[model samples]
Target: MMTALLLHGYASGIYSSRRIARAAVERADFMMIVAGDAPDFRTISEFRRRHLKALADLFVQVLKLAEKAGLVKLGHVALDGTKIKANASKHKAMSYD
Candidate 1:
């Protein structure tokens, strides 16, 4: 769980994080225990609202684990803009920001 959440902070979603989690799980090198399935991949707004609190809690747990492991240090970070090719009409997104 700790590994999954840590990977999630670096990656975008659970689907991507799961790949990293699988790799870590394969190696018996770490002391961490892998548990449970990754979160669902649905992108619905309602799902986000419903899971917001749970996600926040999970984030706190991840940070605590990092602190315990002495890995809580800032390093080089990268932010990537999502390239969304919408099939919907562009006019739907044309509004004052």
Candidate 2:
């Protein structure tokens, strides 16, 4: 389960997922799995293409662990997204605040 969280949470490309994974890893109660070193951006991109579903499954496993630990309840859910223009976009070339 810890292994799953490491691979899915921190290693996943999604920013929020990585944050969740990092939080899980920091918890002393959870089992730990040491991945030697951080992969470079290119390697991460390759991993996403090659192992996306597997990583997603790991995320799910982490969620189950949280449920088992009584950290999160099984219930309703909501989702939302906010889009900001990329730095490369000339129309939105503003300094990050």
Candidate 3:
């Protein structure tokens, strides 16, 4: 589940939770889950919402370890962007502020 979410967010070029779920189901190597069953959008959203902080922290730790191993330069950051396909209509999405 974690792998699926990360791949979807980082590599799958998908932002919609539904699409992420679909990608995981259709592309096993792209977002392979160890459990063999792909999760739905709601489950993926809940997992991300619940573990956002942990994920951030884990990413930081990976960067630090990479720096220590000379795999990445210290004080340097890389930014990656992917085109996201929006599935929601104006009627389905709203802003709080």
TM values, all candidates: 0.33, 0.43, 0.54
lDDT of 2 at 27: 48
Best by lDDT: 3
RMSD of 1: 13.3
What is each predicted model's overall lDDT from 0 to 1?
0.51, 0.55, 0.71
- What is candidate 3's lDDT per residue for 29-88, written digit by digit as tens? 644553557777898788778988887787677778888999878775778898899979
Ranking of all candidate structures by their TM-score, best first? 3, 2, 1
Q: What is the lDDT of residue 12 in candidate 3?
A: 42
Q: Which of the predicted structures, 1 or 2, would earn the higher lDDT when compared with the native?
A: 2
Worst 10 residues of 1 by lDDT: 36-45
Candidate 2, residues 1-97, lDDT tens digits: the string is 4334445455444345344444444643222432433334444455566877887786788779989999878888887788876667665777567
Residue range 24-70, candidate 1, lDDT tens digits: 44534321434433333232234445776786787677777887899
What TM-score, to 2 decimals, does candidate 2 have?
0.43
Task: Give residue 59's error in model 1 in angstroms.
Answer: 0.3
Candidates arranged by lDDT, highest first: 3, 2, 1
